[model samples]
Target: MQRDKFLKEIENLNHPNETLVPTHCSYCAMQCGMNLRVNTSTNKIIGVEPRYDWPVTLGKMCPKGVTAYQQTNHEDRLLKPLIRDDASLKGTKEGFREATWDEAYDLIVKRFKELQQNYGKDSLSVYGGVSMTNEKCYLTGKFARVALQTRYIDYNGRFCMASAAGGINRSLGVDRGSTLPWTDIHETDCLFLAGSNTAECHPTSMFRIWAVQERGGYLIIADPRETPIARRADVHLDLRPGTDLALANGILHLLIENGHVDEEFVKNHTNGFEETKQVVKEFTPEYTSQITGVAPEKIIRAAELYGKAPNAIVLFARGIEQQVKGVDNVSAYINMALVTGNIGRPKAGVGTITGQGNGQGGREHGQKADALPGYRKIANPQHVKEIAEVWGIKPEEMPEAGVSAYEMFGLMEQKTIRSLYLLCSNPVVSAPNSNYVRKMLKQLDFMVCVDFFLSESAEYADVVLPTTTWAEDEGTTTNVEGRVIKINRAQKPLGESKPDWQIQVELAERLGRGKYFSHLKTSKDIFDELRRASKGGNADYYGVTWEKIEKQNGVFWPCKSEDDPGTPHMFLDKKFYHPDGKAKIFALPYTPPAEEPDEEYPLRLTTGRVVYHYLSGNQTRRIQFLKDMSPEPFVEVHPDTAQKYNISHEEKVRLFTRRGEVIYKVKITEAIRKDTVFVPYHWDFERAANILTNPALDPISRMPEFKACAAEIEKIEVKKVQ
Candidate 1:
């Protein structure tokens, strides 16, 4: 009956004048399957329909996914290359004039050459984002090292997924986002979600999360705000922001005291348990409550629920991973699963809720500063030699590793990195301490932005190259589940805009680096090279051919050869990737936020996404429906805090931190901690939450502290018009 009903729904979506092109949503890592309705006569995408056949998000589409098609044909799209004639108008949208591709490429080459000749090759830098296909990301690393010959190449994932990557890699010795597939989520006996607001951020996955509860399984959440998912959780540990380490340790202590430790698993499959136990022994519930501000009883209850479950999965997102101790927080949570022996099997493991579309594949294929393709370290000589062999360059010619994304801005401030090639990101709105980021961008000797829209960051560029949307490009992206799925092209490039891969190829030729890139004429050509480049490394994809992806719906990696079916459940044999074939349990110590609440800034401030917006609101803000749903940013304040500050609901208030300040309309709600305020970081300019966010970097991941900072709200006095 369900199959027949699904067939009927598909039949109703069919139209004689339109052809349905199957693909995945170009938004979050859920990568919900969808079919783009393309007008056959015009070769343009007209609408979108949910892909009921796709197993990950069967027929489910979030508002962003439903309106994703609108981005390709939107009026705000950059139709031609833009050249800024006046250097004085760098931070505004006033100086750009439409130019041909030749003029734009010539100007970029001339400026880049002049900068490199004047101040060494390291003057040029590449700032990338992970929203693109794996093909584009792989080529981007090659483009920077081979063509540009620069050591200052980093990506936006530094702010989003770096901590999760660092933590998972340290604990399990491999970072695949999720150990068990999304299909295993519903069957899990318990779920301990830390810092993720799955209901709004990845709405399509809610069905599976809710299904766990429908089966009488327990759900535990740890967050500062009572998010939609937290409201429904059996236990909500509303800990103070930046205190996830303490809360996780508190739970670990109880798990040990209550005799929940799997002694056999700890003795065999893991190491460092004795040291970890020693560290957590002092993290009693009362002591932890003093640090995290979550009740002792709540912490004990959460530990009991998770420890008692036969099969459980631990998951987290930016909330815990966007702090100074982000990596520690991640490992602390994974410790729970490791101690409970709830990993290395079906329906049990640890995973992260990936924030971007290709967060999994993008990080793997070397967009990061210190990473080579296949999660290989650039610092390792053998890894450099391996990648150099594929690029046909001598190993010595490869540049050394660069700094993280935010640190690149620091280099720019010092005039070390004079030029920047920015793509797939809007740092002006997304980066922490964005006011300083914007200032540094304006001071760049040469700046180029490649994006479909004129983002806030693009407004500061000397040249803006038009790039095609996802619907106009064909490639592969690994979903949050680490499944490599093919994204089919639904339409040709509208106007003169080109795909980012083609743009880089053309740019490389102009810069006299054609031999390394000219052979890649199509996305498949690039993917074929990428597959070989990724062979034998941790994120091996040599066997994951386009044909295989199409045949299997999607193929999970570390697929080594053609006959290999791919790994869906990681560490199935209980063999970890560490040298000793054992997962590590770190003895992490608790740490406070870089900037805690003080006399001047007396409240905790945290930032996150809204259902109506993706990162930075570059694409979604242009869609009328998404814009109408969330027109501006607001600060969520507890009623008691609002009253104390003499602020009223919907009243404009000044929310200021040590970095900067923004005026937001008050949204009084008891869903948030009385001592904390929440702001969605989607809007740009003065409304952006990044303005108030701290730029303190995590020691291991170099992730900026976006989730917690000291802040204070002031009631704005409106003067009468008279």
Candidate 2:
């Protein structure tokens, strides 16, 4: 009774609290639903926690979600529009001059029109940043199609999920919507995670995998390094980098030899089974083991576990797709799922995990090189007609297929792409081959960047338009699981910064394209238009509207009608989008890395993310706390290699590749493989990993091999201070 009275008295204490509003995570594509508890009295977000009712996130969010509010308050945020006053020269006295929104929009319109008149529309390229909301993405696509009449439009997904989209599009008829019921992770008896480190990257989603493993279910982890997930896995296969296709094919071979395949499922639900089987027969365990570096017996055991398990989920990430053989690797994994009857059902399918925050949502709304809204292929006559009618333009006017991201940069170097309008992306630090990207930027006649910060790439911009961050804006985003969520405005725009859509719309109107850039008052108007475009398409998101979403936490796509419940998982039935209602299977083969270590560079360098920082350190690096924890970039070398080279921990080391060299501190550890060294690529100055990265790209996807690059490392002796 005394304890109860004390608790009641504590609860009754008069303390002001903020009004909590519902929102979505802005960090990654997971788009975890969250609640922003704002201090109404102070006009600041005091706390952020997950929304319990959302089925996808399930009240789980990563650290990035909880701390996203910091981005709004970060000192480095650009609060006003900046225009370059001096000439466009690198390291020049050309600093940014603050401009009003009207001035910025007017100048942008004048330049775009001048460029169009001077050069063909094909000469202008528009690159969308995936972090923008679906509403913003819709407006961007509209601007490219209706205003500029430029078919040379694409998003950053070409760098992140191109192979996943391309390979899946060829086989399953739809590029990027999840075929793997993601929520089915709870029901999965065995989870095979390849190339992804869930614990560090997708922390909240890993709960499902952890639950399965904790219940005596098996978890197979395949990666070059012994990541946190790999250490906790039931079976860890440290396969060689860029050899994922070999292992996937070997697994299929084992399943075929052991007769573990479901013939009935294959015959009823799939096509190309006979040819797939014949192809797998040649990829014997012995043959693949030699290439993938996995023992034949171990491959058989891994296959048996996956094939025999009642429910199995195979998840892949950029580690498999950011390679010259990325398309092949994705095909090999998808083929395994089809052969073993692991798809089109709950808890069993091929899952392609995206890297960027809004990669899925961005692509879903016509942000790809060869795709329009709703995952519709530009080559398809029907798809082209549908989009053409919606945009009030002739289908024939659209470019057959614009250049991919890698090709776009290559064209910039060759002087084919003279002008570029970059929205929300920092290509200087994020794109592979950092030095090459920097040099190409210098070659461009005009480059415009719209972002919240003066990022690494913004340094070369002829014009920089300050844009609002997530906290200062209102929009919607989609998660990795195809779940759509909203981003609520918790505060006003920082100084002169405006929402991305507003800036683009304002510019479009100024350029006399007001008809296409109409309905710019609110995000709701833009979202309603997106819904109209999605009607009857592969990803029908008609069920959701601004009114409906505001009343609830969120809704997933394929909500085609008013009474329809948003789709939880796609492709639950055996029916596919193909003509015959069957998914095609492609046989993928392993291809070596673009650059291989030789006598001059006798080591392999692998680049990846750090726990504290995100890609290129655009936002996270600005945080003093995060920066303090990870002050400088460092190279992780194995103990044996470090000892052989007489390198000590914290000692400066020079790493050299064919392209360039960088110096970083040595971090000797057993976690890294013997001949391989691990380096975080987020740093800008001391050791930019992209400087030494391979620029070779996948044939089908056009994504460069940012993960695997050949290099050599040596200890650099410091001279004694005078």
Candidate 3:
């Protein structure tokens, strides 16, 4: 019987030599290189492997990349367009009535025209998201600015990486796609990992950090919580949240006072040295240590490690830029890098680790409110004229820069924004202050959402356009190191779903703005134009053609010609693009957090991601394997604090803030600080963390304070309802 069963199993096997297709991960933007293999006969993806030959992890990937196959052909994916016949029905649909692609596009065109004709074009707002491909991002910007002529346009980047974009542009005259590549960090002798947890967020890259440690390289981490990476660091400076500016300025003070300053490098490579030095003198270690809650000795040590190291790489993330004073924090770090003569050299960099999969690409391609492709400010007359001339339109025809995400959501509630178009994002669950964002979406006259699944945001849409997932799409994405990787589709659409760029093109043509999309009949056409537009910019890809990039796996920007190998590290010669031909070191002061512990809310609250779940739980939670790894939400509280509150591990507790409260299971551990609690912002059950997140946005970048807030905890009675 066993031999007969084995023979039957062998007979069932077919097409064993299926070829694999090359592609990029569609999850978060680390863009870990990958390949997906499909059975030739069944056309079914059978396995996945890392792009080991490629740079940046040498093709290694985290758990997210290994399990990306689960997303393709998943049963929960949206295969058809869904229209809400009744707003009050929720998912209780009156009917799902499948329609042709033309029907869906025509319906959207009709509704959009009605909105424009009834309300002014400015009354309609389009929200681009980070999950989109480069082709979709470019087309979305073109459609909104040309076809719709809407002044209200922004994306979820405001919630995460807007400040990084603003600060980088202000300092370097352009936005993302780093001049520096990932290999630069490996060349450094010292790694100043501040306000970031790469061990947890980007585990594959952590191996590189381990390699750095093996080489006797120093590691210094600055964060409020002693994260896993921090515990392993040579020195961990637990600075108060939102006080990074003070810590950075104090380090600058120590470097100058100890004569560790690279005078030759500074004089030859930087500007504003005298004024910046004078301003930083006041931020002495003793003075800033008090405000930042770090010891003076530790502050001095951090400065020594950074200043004395032959090469130091300064890195930050949402923890630093997702605060009310985010821009100031970034400005201070930039000054520190420039003063130490740390930037523009191999392994000596000051850069932000972007959060979303395409946050870097999205901002670079002009999805930002104030930007056009290539980081050209929309408000700049010369830039506007240049883009307009390229698009064959009048410069004055373009609308002024508009409100950001927070302001746009507020306007929706105020009826100022009548129509809302959200692309590939779930703002209902992802936005800070969930209740208010949900209510505002409900109040909007019409809401249109484009996504691969029926997410929280799609639930409220009047019309939901099913979008193609990464396995069923084609385009390009820039990784954290600014390497542009291609994403070739491996599967066809499930039903009538289409790629986002195609939808945008069809809609534009239907709106009688076919001329706007006339130059681009395909995504490759747009990619070529993007290279042309970005010719002289910071992320120059003009030299990288399709044939060369595919053959090479990927290439970093500044590959201006087909014959040129892409640049891996930026600013190696200290040649800055500033008018003075030198990087400017700004003098900035630190401020307190937007929210803090008070009488009512007597503890500090911080939010972050977990190993198993991605932001908003849009896709990760749906995976049965991943869900089993971390099935429910929980709050990490120190045992001492939990005992004082009479809370126990696995016991239910209610976490409250001024805005809202959520009940979650408790995990009492000594790994956390005494007065602070850590909650992963993954679950969206009754206790979504974003529900209690403060909406205090940065005045300059308009990014919400997602890192730190004030809150209280209480034991909740787990009552069972019959």
Which candidate ranks first by lDDT, i.e. highest?
1
| Each prediction's TM-score versus the true structure | 0.98, 0.94, 0.94
Q: Per-residue lDDT for 309-412 in model 3, tens only?
A: 98888888887888888887877777777777777777787788877888887777677888887777787898888778777789999888988988899888
The candidate maximizing TM-score is 1
Compute the lDDT of residue 46 as modeled in candidate 3: 60
Is 1 or 3 the stronger prediction by TM-score? 1
- Predicted candidate 2, C-alpha RMSD: 3.8
| Poorly placed runs, candidate 2 (over 4 Å) | 1-17, 88-94, 547-553, 720-722
**Which runs in model 1 stand beyond 4 Å of their true positions?**
1-14, 720-722
**C-alpha local distance difference test of each model:** 0.94, 0.78, 0.79
RMSD of each: 3.0, 3.8, 3.1
lDDT of 2: 0.78
Taking the candidates one at a time, how many backbone clashes does each contain?
A: 0, 4, 7
lDDT of model 3, residue 56: 74
Compare candidates 2 and 3 on lDDT and give the better one. Answer: 3
lDDT per residue for candidate 2 within 1-722, as digits (tens), equals 74786575455334366566777777767777777766677776655657887666689976566667778767887887777876545523267788877777677777777787787776678888788889888788777767777777887778888888777777777765466546778688888888887777777787788888777788988888889888888777777777788888888888888887888988887888777677777778788878777777777778888989987888888888888888888878888788888887877877787677778778877877787877777889999898888776788866666878767888887766777888878777778878888888877777788888888778788788888888778877777866677788987787778898887777777777787667668888888878878888877777887666666555667789877767666578787778898888775545678777688788888888876777778888777567777777889998999999998998989997888899988988887788789888888843688888888888888888987878898678778999
